[model samples]
Target: MSEITPDLVRHLGVLARIQLSDEEVQSLTGQLDAIVDNIAKVSEVATPEVVATSHPIPLENVFRPDVVQQQLTREQVLRNAPDQADGRFRVTAILGEEQ
Candidate 1:
């Protein structure tokens, strides 16, 4: 088991340019050691055949049938636009070009 020492934590703090008090160093030493131990346990149980994944359950693509139905008319959609051209919504040209 890897043990974290106060000296190591203090060195890390210096390297990170963080200021830590004696009490904070003592607290972090134990917390870091616990985290390392838990990671070690997980590594032990992991195997070559077991693929590493971020989620516990298998993920699948969920899709719905693609069907077309009656949608809003051109006039109905143009009503919400701040500016409208002959039959389409009008907006300022983005690429420094005139339509």
Candidate 2:
């Protein structure tokens, strides 16, 4: 059995900046112990030849090939703008600077 003592839980709470009550600490200790045991069992079955994967099924990128195509001109893009300056969209200064 993995050692999941109350003192360990208390130390973890302190490091995590959480105020855990005694009851909560006691509950978590058992839950965490079970989780650790499960992980240990899984590790025991894992072999050196077995491939590691993040998902159960094979994955592939389902994206279209990147290709340059005809795009809207700057004039067409800025046509709906409320304000324009120097061939670019203009907005109010927001750096607390007087404009």
Candidate 3:
């Protein structure tokens, strides 16, 4: 088992700039010790022969072939615009009077 002492918890609290009370340090020491022990158990089973995987089941990517299709004309697109100028949509200048 990992030795997560109260002193270690106090040192970590100091490093993080947090003022941990005596009660909090006692509580965290037990919690951190349990977490470290569990991690050690997992490490034991993780060997060179065992491959690390994010998921239990295998997954594959499904892709579709890209195909070109008919598109709308410039006039058809500009017809839905709120304002148009020189065959394109026009909006008020944001930064200055220059367009």
Cα lDDT tens digits for candidate 3, 1-99: 798999999999988889999999999999999999999999999999999998899999899998999999999999999999999999877886443
Q: Please give me the total number of clashing residue pairs in predicted model 2.
A: 0
Question: Superposing every Cα of model 1 onto the true structure, what RMSD results?
Answer: 10.4
**Candidate 2 per-residue C-alpha lDDT over 13-89 given as tens digits, one digit per residue, 9 for 90 to 100:** 99888999999999999988888889999898888988887999889989999999999999999999999998899
lDDT of 1 by residue, 7-32 (tens): 99999999888999999999999999
**TM-score for each prediction?**
0.56, 0.60, 0.55
Candidate 2 versus truth, CA RMSD in Å, comes to: 8.6
Which residue pairs in model 2 clash with each other?
none
All models: lDDT?
Answer: 0.92, 0.91, 0.94
Question: Highest TM-score: which candidate?
Answer: 2
Judged by lDDT against the true structure, how good is candidate 1? Answer: 0.92
lDDT sort, best first? 3, 1, 2
Residue 82 miss distance in model 3 (angstroms): 35
Best-fitting candidate, scored by lDDT: 3
